[model samples]
Target: MTDLTGTSFEFPGEYYEIMRKDFRNLDAETEFLASLLPDAGTVLDLGCGTGSNLRALRERGHRGTGVDQSAAFLEYARAAGDEGISYVEARAEEYRTDERYDLVYSLFMTLNYLDRGRLPAVLRSVRELLNPGGQVVLEFGHLLNFVDSFQPNSVGHHRRDGVLITRLARQFINAHAANWRNEETLLVRTADGTVAMYDNFFDQAVLTGPEVRELLAAAGLTITAEYGGFRKEPAPFHGRGPLVIVATATPADTASDTAQQEENQA
Candidate 1:
């Protein structure tokens, strides 16, 4: 019941990077993404927080554009001075560009943040943004994973460069609605011995395997692969980890014909 929401300080991008450093395997993740794309291909990162993945991909010789709604995260990403990588402030679902990409990816359970009703729009946008033979990689929290591993409360502490951050988390699962709520409080101490607290919360829709497949299909995408983690571990229907999906867009002509047919029928 500890709520740090009363604190005035907003979560900064520097601290966000520090918080993720402990768990996020940047090399493995970038390798996985690289394996999916051709050499020197263009990439789009939806909900790309702080542009970490894009920055990593840029180093691997790929050009990347990242879109996120958080201005603080975008500001930090732009300040990194990474060549061939750019950051834009926009919601994933509403983001549109004349530029097509060889690959589009969303990571870190970003899709789960959207309501179920909004998934089609997001997926459709992804499909439209793909170049010929383009693919999309999505990472989301699977319902089974949450069911298998549900911890109500946890605490973590990280220290770097004279900054100490203590994070407390609480989670609630509503099976009936297939919803997961995570609340977090962070106490950050600077080198000057000044301390500040911040609170964050997320409500996620835990979609079933079938629901995910159906949504992808509805967006004119075909699943090419599925994985349980960053490694190429198979994601069985009853898997117990975050779902990583690889999908390719349907042929543009075919998709266009299907849309025309549907419109005519309606």
Candidate 2:
């Protein structure tokens, strides 16, 4: 098992489209996220894989830059020829830019790939990159989802353009910590009857609702809303769906005053 700690799991760039095709409702998700911003808003996509969401958002009249650590994914995204979308290869925690954005979003449990030590830095970077009153949206697996509905093993098969791909997944949860491990094997068969196999594994941290709120607050962000899914349903403290968090930077003066109070108390 290849340990994928603090990195995006390795997946064949060419197979990304096929693997992710039915995994998400791209149109609905784009509409949901776009409704949060003004017309023609500038956006930043953190951990943007293959720039799919960025492309969809671009089509909705929004221009954005995508940041991902995978060169292969970035290369594939750039080849799409989207006029206003730009790709940057960088990890979420280390990515910085002089251009502030009206909205910054990281989706599909991207932040979970980071452990507790790195998550704060990533959140702070996100806060610094947002414009005044700008929003940050994140989608991640919550503790409840993992604890209550985790499936240990699953298999999926997808075929596209004369290629057949089969994915087998196994999950292991840490009983003592807010983390889990996933092992995956991919089998690909091409039109010429050549077969290839790949095996890898990754770890993810699962934070509870309160833990997530606390982390965001400590990063100088205030949670504006939470949803259970893309449909904008109220987020339950315990559930089986991913948590969609919408937050904005706390007022500078307010954050400063709070920090001062904490120091004085200490």
Candidate 3:
């Protein structure tokens, strides 16, 4: 998430490989998003690890840029030399672009990597990077994802691309915001029977639906849709799965209205 600032942990060399191998939702995610894009639209994937989503978009006659903090992930993506997909290595919160995109998305709860203090910057950045009427699709784990959904401790196995991985995940919820932090240990067995392991750690803020909408409004963005899962259904009052938000840059009139309301409050 934040490059382990004020923290100590070794980043796994094969982190991206384990993620690509274990998490099996990239295709489904791209298909869900493809149905929502405008014709020939461009996308910018914040925290686009390994550029898998962008690859899927390219096959559908669309192109985009992928930005991430990991050089290894970006290099792996660039090796494809796919003209349709470009990448940059930068932290999501500090990165900016002069060119705007028709669709800007951060999937797999990448935004959660930014702690509460820095989320506003990302919201503003999304606002600036989006064209008028363009939408930003953000998916992130919610407090309920841990509180009501995932178990406190669990293990799973994945076998793909000639690698066998066993993941043991432990989650802890902070008392106040109910923010969820995860420490995952991966045991990877290579085809040659080499065994390696590493610990992956990250935390997500427990910002609720109201906080998200308010932050978007403050950033001159309007929420067009919010959901609990990938199926595009409305999120329950509290529930499992991520809180997926689809928002657009507010038009001039809506911006004016929001300013007026702020002034009135003052």
Cα lDDT for residue 31, candidate 3? 76
**Residues 75-184, model 3: lDDT tens digits:** 77787555888788887887877988889999887877777788887898888998767899988776566567757898988776687788898877666655677788
- Report the CA-based lDDT of candidate 1 relative to the real structure: 0.85
Q: Order the candidates by lDDT, highest first — what do you get?
A: 2, 1, 3
User: Candidate 1 residues 123-228, lDDT tens each?
Assistant: 9889989999999999988878878878899999988899999999998866666778888899999999999988888777888778988899879998999888
Tell me which residue pairs clash in candidate 3: none
lDDT of candidate model 3 versus the reference = 0.77
Better structure of 1 and 2 per TM-score: 2
* Candidate 2's TM-score: 0.91
The collision pairs in model 1 are none
Q: CA lDDT, every prediction?
A: 0.85, 0.85, 0.77
- Per-candidate TM equals 0.88, 0.91, 0.88
| Candidate 1 local lDDT, residue 100 | 95
Q: Give the alpha carbon lDDT tens digit for every residue of 1-266 in model 2.
A: 44435544566677777788868888878988898888899899998888899989998899999988888788888987658988898878778789999999999888787777888888988999998879999998888788887779999898998999999999987756657888889999988999998776778887777888888998999998889888888877668788999999999899999889989999
TM-score of model number 1 = 0.88
Alpha carbon lDDT at 61, candidate 1: 90
Q: Which whole-number lDDT from 0 to 100 does residue 222 have in model 2?
A: 91
